[model samples]
Target: MKVSVWDTYVSREDGKQMHFDILVPSDLKDENTIFNFGKSYLKSKPFATKGLTSKECRFCHVEQASESIEEAIRSKGYYIIEMENCN
Candidate 1:
């Protein structure tokens, strides 16, 4: 499946950065939905900052989804690929 990748960076309360990619189907063009997905992901993190907006997250590109990513998107409407400082 093809997915749109939204590159995201959020600041942690401890003054670090969290970098991740939010992947949704390529046809999904709603920024609000994408940002909400990001917000949901933040809620799962201990370092979650209270802000997830267009400034922190932007549409990066569209690419083929890996099997795991496709499965995740199929189940939850989106998938997340953590890039940095996510632990």
Candidate 2:
């Protein structure tokens, strides 16, 4: 199994920006696939929750700004798969 990564930035509620990556399989290359993968990846994270906010925790920014970042990743086509598969 191979993994694809998309690098991007997210803005906190305080307007602080942070960088993170959206990871998926290289086989899932389409925008819809990447978008759906982003949603699933976010929902599966421990930090994800209802009414998530970026008030004090920067990590919460990820949950709040996931859609936009995912769209940006899809639009930019900035994704890569590592040679080695962790799977």
Candidate 3:
């Protein structure tokens, strides 16, 4: 997968802005697998698994991951939204 940093944008809820990186995978199948793996991994985290006590950014990351999956499906392409919440 090839990753590229894109422009950043401020979220609606807060004044804080974040940089976004887009990951473009050569193969669509790989992208699908990666997305699923990411979701499973994040959802398995203690914070996410516990309840609503998780940080807001954690929830945002999950939403972003879901968006990436949809983008891949709609365009028949691969992409990821890398934010500070991501390692």
The C-alpha TM-scores of every prediction are 0.96, 0.39, 0.26
lDDT of 2 by residue, 1-87 (tens): 344555534343444444545554455556555554444543544443332233311211112334544565566543322222111
- Per-residue lDDT for 1-87 in model 1, tens only? 999999999998888889999999999999999999999999998765848999999999999999998888999999989999988
The global C-alpha lDDT for each of the candidates, from Candidate 1 onward, is 0.93, 0.41, 0.37
For residues 1-87, could you state the per-residue lDDT of candidate 3 as single tens digits? 233222233232233333343334333334334444344434543332221111222212222335556567357443545665332
In model 2, the clashing pairs are: none
Name the candidate, 1 or 3, with the larger lDDT value: 1
Q: What TM-score would candidate 3 get against the native?
A: 0.26
Q: Could you tell me how far off, in angstroms, the CA of residue 46 lies in candidate 3 after the best superposition?
A: 18
Over 4 Å off, model 3 = 1-5, 25-76, 85-87
lDDT for predicted candidate 1 compared with the true structure: 0.93
Between candidates 1 and 2, the lDDT winner: 1
